[model samples]
Target: MIVIVDYGLGNLGSIKNMLRKIGYSSMVSSNPDEISKASKLILPGVGAFDTGMRHLTDSGLLDILGYKALAEKIPVLGICLGAQLMTRSSEEGCLSGLGWFEAETLKFQFDGIAGKWPLPNIGWRDVFDVNGSPLLSGFNSTPRFYFVHSYFLKPLEQDIVSMNVSYGFEYACGLSKGNLHCVQFHPEKSHKFGMQLLRNFSELT
Candidate 1:
């Protein structure tokens, strides 16, 4: 069964509800054993970088999840701040991340167009596939997903980027490498396209 990690840093109920709507059986728990036994895992987060990491560390899930997702190669999906936690570090906080990916989370810099758009880019934005990821499969065209973040991941390896979203500038929003998958957008809130993406993830081995 898919396990939605409850580290006190995410919208656990909403994610579980979304999974239910998609007809997927999932459990939300902070129990290490339950997490270790998961066929698939969803790491959901909605908060600051340091706070999320602290919660995960305190939840006693760090090592088990590391083994499952990294060593054992179990399929894992990280949403929003969860995705950022998969990286090495973040500009939002000084804490080191899970370091699963050789990437860094950076605050949005509007550069010359600073006043043109708002920070923490909220609302819907279209994401374009970069490498035709299985998670993005079955889509006839680019799909727009809900985004509400001030920072984005910058993976060192360009090949790992599954999709990108253009704000004031283009940034990597979807990352896939081996059994690990991460999306900056909230598929759980993105309507049909989001549901399709979640469905695709549920089907992954």
Candidate 2:
């Protein structure tokens, strides 16, 4: 079974509904027992970086989550703030992240020509699957996903980047490294594209 990690944040119901719509069953839980039994894990979150990490720490699922993702190497997906938590740190907060990747989350600083763009880039934007990851499988045309954030990821290793997006300038929007994967957009709110992406994730071994 797939377990959506409920760390006091995220669109849990929306994610569960999307998964169900795609014919995949999932449970929302913060229980370690339920999480340990999961074949795959989806770490979903929103809100401030420090707060998200604090909630996860307070939930006492961090150790098991780390074990599952790092030791057991289960298929783990992180979304939005969850994705940021995977990095080493973030400019938005002083707290250390999950450190799944050698990356950092940075706030969008518009200047010069880029200054025309607004903060908290909130809308559907085009995404380029540069690496053609299986997570993005079956996308015939250019795929777009719903994004609502003021921060973006800057991975040290570019090869791990699966998708890139441009608001004022290009930045990594999706990442894939072995059994770990993450996306900056909200697939649950993305309609057909979201459904297809979630379906693809379900098919991952």
Instruction: Name the candidate that leads on lDDT.
Output: 2
User: Alpha carbon lDDT of residue 145, candidate 1?
Assistant: 99
Worst 10 residues of 1 by lDDT: 111-120
Global lDDT of each candidate: 0.92, 0.93
Q: What lDDT score is found at residue 19 in candidate 2? A: 99
lDDT for 201 in candidate 2 is 89
Candidate 1 clash figure, as a count: 0
Candidate number of the best TM-score: 2
| Backbone clashes in model 1, listed as residue pairs | none
lDDT, candidate 1, residue 138? 89
* Candidate 2 TM-score over all chains jointly: 0.98
Tens-digit lDDT string for candidate 2 (1-205): 9899999999999999999988999999999999999999999999999999999999999999999999999999999999999999999999999999888999997776535788799999988887887777898878889999999999999988989999999999999899999999999999999999999988888
Q: Which parts of model 1 are misplaced by more than 4 Å?
A: none
